[model samples]
Target: MPRWGMVIDLEKCTGCQACTAACQMENCRLPGEMWQDVLFYSEGEYPSGKLTWLPRPCMHCENPSCVAVCPTGAAYKAENGAVLIDWERCIGCKYCMIACPYGVRFYAEEKQKTQPDIRDVFPAKGDKVWDPPYKMPEQVQDPKHGVGVQPKNVVSKCTFCYHRTSKAPTGLKDLDPNDPATRKFTPACVVTCAPGARYFGDLDNPESNVRKLIAEKRGTRLLDQTGNRPQVYYLAGEAPVIPETRSVRKPKQSPET
Candidate 1:
């Protein structure tokens, strides 16, 4: 089995939120509920300040903290090395949410439904209808994946688009467009990304493009200090720095002493 992982290049990302939107539509997530998000940070003084943007997703740690603290064992590593939530087994304890340093896990408060006002599922001018077989009224239901028809009090997060991955035909397990091995490979986010910042593949394979990017760019994992061994890595940007200066002021004198 290959160790599946994703590499997001911040240098290449424009903070367009394309990846974020794609993930939501593909997973049919509720409004205001996001499986992936882009974080913005600033450094330095006003004139020379630099802005940095980072795209965050479920780290899918090799030694996932979410899995360790889950009382119900609902969060576990999948066969393809993706961290997944077992909705049926999940008790909505929020332990995984607390344990995850990346803050990727979320609990669904209200059942998520497709908005009636929205005409298209994606902004690319396509039909907004639900894919067949997984379709349901308001909320989708899948007995095999134990998703879509989630209970009111269950935790949910990124599954690496497992619903699509499981059905991926053989010889298309990876995401290499040029290679025949990934001929049928497609992930909702990866497919919808207009900038092509997100790259997914078998991290265990040194020959993989993702691995090559890691090697050449020296990509760094987020919050590596936590020892979570996150599979997601980031490529940062170089922005100008600004300095802060302080001035001394005279003390106030007593009036009408």
Candidate 2:
């Protein structure tokens, strides 16, 4: 099987949150809990300040800290290199949340982050934790891999759209959104990215677009110090390089002060 992975061309990203929205809708997540986020921050002080953005999804690390910390074996790495959570096995210990350095994992239960608790408003129907007005493809609803609307008390993160990718023909290298042949099978975030900043493919294939971009552009992963060895790579290009998390820059001090 192909070692599935993703490469993001940061130079092309516009931080429009199309990827974020697409992930929410495709995965049927609650409003406050999105699998993707585009963080914005500034560098330098006023006159010289520059605004930059970084879009973060689950890294799907080869040595996932989340997987390592899950006591119940609820979180496990799939053969294709995806870190997936079996909602049925997950006990909502929140160990994965604390283990993740990227702040990507989310556990939403009785405590609602969004006011009025959408869960209580919509209420769950049958096995589903909450019924979303928008219906997702029935095929994508697999709790075993943490797809579809999450069950109560389970930690959830991105699965690289495994439901689609797993069905792709054997030995396939890349799933490019621009490619008509692979467009339907591409990850929702990758497909909805208006600027075409994202690319998903087999990392093991040297001929794949994702691998080629990583090689030519010297792609980098976030939080390298953690030694998780992320499968996701960022081709920063002309965009600001994200070496570490960006803390919001404070304003410059006046001479009078």
Candidate 3:
């Protein structure tokens, strides 16, 4: 059984958000409904401050809390270690959303019906090849598998590109440094990374790059204390840490003299 996983090299990642863009286009997620996010913040104070951008995706934990809390079994881990959501079974109770420690889950909102924009309106060409308006492959539209064309009022998250990965031969090990078909099976975010900071493969395979990188780079998991045992590993001097939740406060205005 292949246990898929990812290794993110923080040092090499510039956080340009290419991965986020690729995921959106591949999954057809709406604006602001990013399956992956690049979080940026400053470290230190004053002139010595430094900026860091961290890429975040689903952890696909070995002991996923989302799966544990799901009321209708919408959240489940696949045979290859992908944490998937069966949109058909999802009841929009938000239990898995609350249980996810990584904050990767999202509840899809109902899109308002609207007419095409003036600029987008075009005359009917009568089935022209390479038309301006083309239908992109909708991954979330599969109701049975819940892989593409995400429906409204359902919780959705990353699936490690299950549609692609599930096609890989059982004997296959490394996703990268392998056959073209195997490479095509990896998540879009993994291959789209320009800096090669993201790696995906079977973590259980000794020869896999994911395992090799984690071992050689001293990779670590986030919030391991939570006992979720996330499969995603970070290889860097320090893994990105999510700050404790705090109430937002408005900036104080200067008093008039």
Which candidate's lDDT is highest?
2
TM-score of each: 0.76, 0.92, 0.81
**How do all the candidates rank in terms of lDDT, highest first?**
2, 3, 1
Each model's C-alpha lDDT?
A: 0.67, 0.85, 0.75
Residue 9 local lDDT, model 3: 87
**Judged by lDDT relative to the true structure, which candidate is superior, 1 or 3?**
3
Residue-by-residue lDDT tens digits, candidate 3, 55-75? 889999999999999989988
TM-score order, best first, reads 2, 3, 1
Report model 3's TM-score to 2 decimal places. Answer: 0.81
Best by TM-score: 2
lDDT score at residue 39, model 3, on the 0-100 scale? 74
lDDT of 2 at 55: 90
Q: In candidate 2, how many clashes are counted?
A: 0
Question: Tell me, what's the RMSD of every candidate?
Answer: 9.1, 2.5, 6.0
Q: Candidate 2 on 1-257: residue-level lDDT in tens?
A: 88889898888899899999999988888887878988876556557667778899999999999999999999999888889999999999999999988888997765767778887788898766798888577766888988888887788999888888877888789988888988888899999999989999999999998888899999999988899999999998875657575344443542222
The RMSD (Cα, Å) of candidate 2 is: 2.5
How well is each residue in 209-253 modelled by candidate 1, as lDDT tens digits?
788888887767876878888887765536321111111231133
